[model samples]
Target: MLSEKSEQFLMSLRLELLKRGKKEDEIEEVVDELRDHLHEAEQRGENVDDVTGGSVNHYIKTISKEMAFDKRIIKMVIGALFAIVAFFLIPRMVSGQLDLSMYRIIFYGLLTFVLLPLELWVLIEMLKKYGNSKKGYIAPILVALGGFLIILAGEFLLREYDGESVIVMEASTIFWLGVILSVVFILVCLYFYQWFYIGVLVYLVLPDLFANTMTDAAPGSKEYINVSTAITLILTVLALVGALAFYARYKKNS
Candidate 1:
């Protein structure tokens, strides 16, 4: 039961507040205050609704269009999707094909079950706290971890499903996963990186898993595995460091 004149005044004030960059909650508080004022006046038996000005609803509509860019729902949507994806990926790691390179399976499985779930939970938490952007760190770290885990899981599941365990199998999986992990870690470092740093760490740490596979890559001998491991480790670490720095800065800025 707001008076027409008071309602119009409130509407104009709301528009002015919007232009001044007042937050949604602030504007809403003003609306409640104006409503209460009108209520008090009406309680006195005065027709404040007929006091003067026109309808306020149309003005409210005009102001709505300007505040459209302050949306936060998209981040929450992304968080939910990340959680669902992590959940689905976890069960797939334990499929019958996980034992090929038991180490690979172990690595990916641990990351998927452990790190991915952590990322998912944190993401959900962040979504719930949409007003805060400090949680953006969760994205990059999970992404880095995902890079290594995904490739390791794939190699292990695929090779184990096919029932292979030769040096060749280990070597192939290591080299490939190393490359994949390194790239993923770099990306994780650069953007939503809280989890992606794991991928970079995996690249640094996973080379020892394939002792016999490297000599074949160089045709020579002694330095083959050592050189390969070093290259992979260096590249992955650099990527992780750079991307992680960027992500950290972004979070701070947000």
Candidate 2:
């Protein structure tokens, strides 16, 4: 049991680190170390201030400065690719039809390139905030929200220019080809230990599987789409659970 003063100091440190943009992993490590030090100090009946040199905020800043940034190139690359796919291929799959234009493609391509990195950073931070303690709800919601936003962006882009949104009777074979490629991409990410990419791909692939099958976007077709959407959500939840379990097992063996 930590003393009240020591717990307060630790919480302050956590908040300071967050404000400094320190990664969650780094903050947790720092807190763990401080906790051990505080435990020893408490056992000795020493003041917590003495352990922190009587300056908690200053120590927090110092630790923040010392922590290295986690700038993984692979993560950035995967995020960028996802942005392109989400904003481009995914909307087509969801609608099962589109009369796309070059200008729309270029516009969304630029938007995705600009925004995806920042979004991925937030996603990673969220994952760190919510550790993998077998909870699947949050992960699916986050993944689905990101994909849904991108799909909406694509729809808006298509809608802006008239005569560019067409209805088709079937999903093109090209779209299925893209699905196969996505599965390959997911496998590759998994091989390289990019678990976040897997989650994103799961959202992309599973929802798409259901959406691709529903070709009727006419009146009274909402029921089919609604059913597909529900199935997609359930699949997303299952994927998260399986992912967490796989991750735990892999870590144990590793």
Candidate 3:
């Protein structure tokens, strides 16, 4: 067995390679080779630092440069776009509203194609630079908070825009579209074994649906909206907690 530090180094290298879009098979092969090498080195009374020439980050970069980018990144991007569309549209479809505006399209496009990827890249760079230090997390946390605030502001602006709707579907059409999207989303998630994302969708959409049925208040009234929002928030928190617990258990078992 390798020392904890060596294991952590290998894990970090693996993550960095993943962020760099290296092939999953190649990453595992590299990791396995490194694991064996590290094990042998540990047996000889050497440490991870000695193996990496005292700079693990440099070693990781060197390895990353030698690996080719995976072509599956294109499929991953398409999947992400589909997921984002489903995430936003499913809730609106539940409310029987399918209003599409140019402004909304542009804003969501920038958010999905630019901001989210930029944030992920920034986070990956931070991870590569700072490793597992607490201080390293502070910058990424701040960036995420800023992004959240920007999203909230954008949403507020969107609601107040008074723009002409580009497309407005009838209730029946919206319902069918929602059903199709939901089926596709569920099937894709199941195929990929992405149970956490399915949980997120359930927590986000079901609360609103249930609140609408349970609350006596008018659908668009402040009271009804508040009840729905509260329920959604509660379920979202529970989903997050459940996901974290599951991840911890998975890691422990692995």
Candidate 4:
């Protein structure tokens, strides 16, 4: 007879393996193999509940009581970089660059070269350390974007002023403000802060980021208005997967 624990474990493993591109036909055999392996370990007093519960954590805790601290530090550092890029690079993109011919090159370079790498690094680290952490990073993104909005607002207002526009000063202030915001937002997200707020924010931002598409203005035209549509779509899909995985893990753990 299959124990309830074994049944749940096999089901979850099947789902997870499917998510990772496994075929249905092979899942049962793989599951049986897994059962055999665990049965061997059971002889030594290990149990399915222990591995699913906190074997991973027990291993990490033994290695470093400070893994949590290290993870936090890494997140904060990435958030800081994002804040800097948002304030400076965004303005450079909107009004065009002062020193570079292609504002896009600099703008996207910051996003690609600096911000994106950091984002991925933080994401990977989050998965490694706490793959079960909060799925909704929306509030944090909104909070960061809000800081950018203020900068955009100030840039708008400042440009209209009778006094000469000081690019350096404007950039510096916005950058710092964004940094402060990222710090706060990241901390909250890590702590699993406000679910409704985060979900609402994600809903609002996702379409803008992912759903819109570049289109040929006229049929048969080769013009592509925005390829960002594709990129955003990918993010949207990944976000959905992350959300589902988080929910499943949350339910299982709880």
User: Whose lDDT is greatest here?
Assistant: 3
Instruction: List the lowest-lDDT window of 10 residues for candidate 2.
Output: 128-137
Model 4, global lDDT = 0.46
What TM-score do all the candidates reach, one by one? 0.26, 0.51, 0.76, 0.25
Query: Please, what are the lDDT tens digits per residue for candidate 4 over residues 61-91?
Result: 3323321222444555565565444444433
Best by TM-score: 3
Residue 233, model 4: Cα distance from true site in angstroms: 16
Name model 1 segments beyond 4 Å from true.
Answer: 1-118, 130-225, 237-254
Query: Each candidate's root-mean-square deviation in Å?
Result: 14.2, 7.3, 3.9, 15.9
108-194: candidate 1 lDDT, tens digit per residue: 465556765566555544433331244444655665676657767766666556444333434345445545544554464457644
- Quantify all predictions' global Cα lDDT against the true fold: 0.51, 0.65, 0.78, 0.46
Model 2's lDDT to the true fold? 0.65
TM-score of 2: 0.51
> lDDT (0-100) at residue 80 of candidate 1?
42
Residue 26 error, candidate 1, Å: 23
User: What value of lDDT does candidate 3 attain over all alpha carbons?
Assistant: 0.78
Ten contiguous residues with the weakest lDDT in model 1: 89-98
lDDT of 3 by residue, 74-182 (tens): 8888887778777877877765566778898888888888888888888777766666678566868877997898889999999999478887778657756766677
Off by over 4 Å in 4: 1-44, 47-100, 133-254
lDDT of 2 at 142: 74
Model 3 ranges with Cα > 4 A deviation: 1-12, 32-69, 171-176, 212-219, 244-254
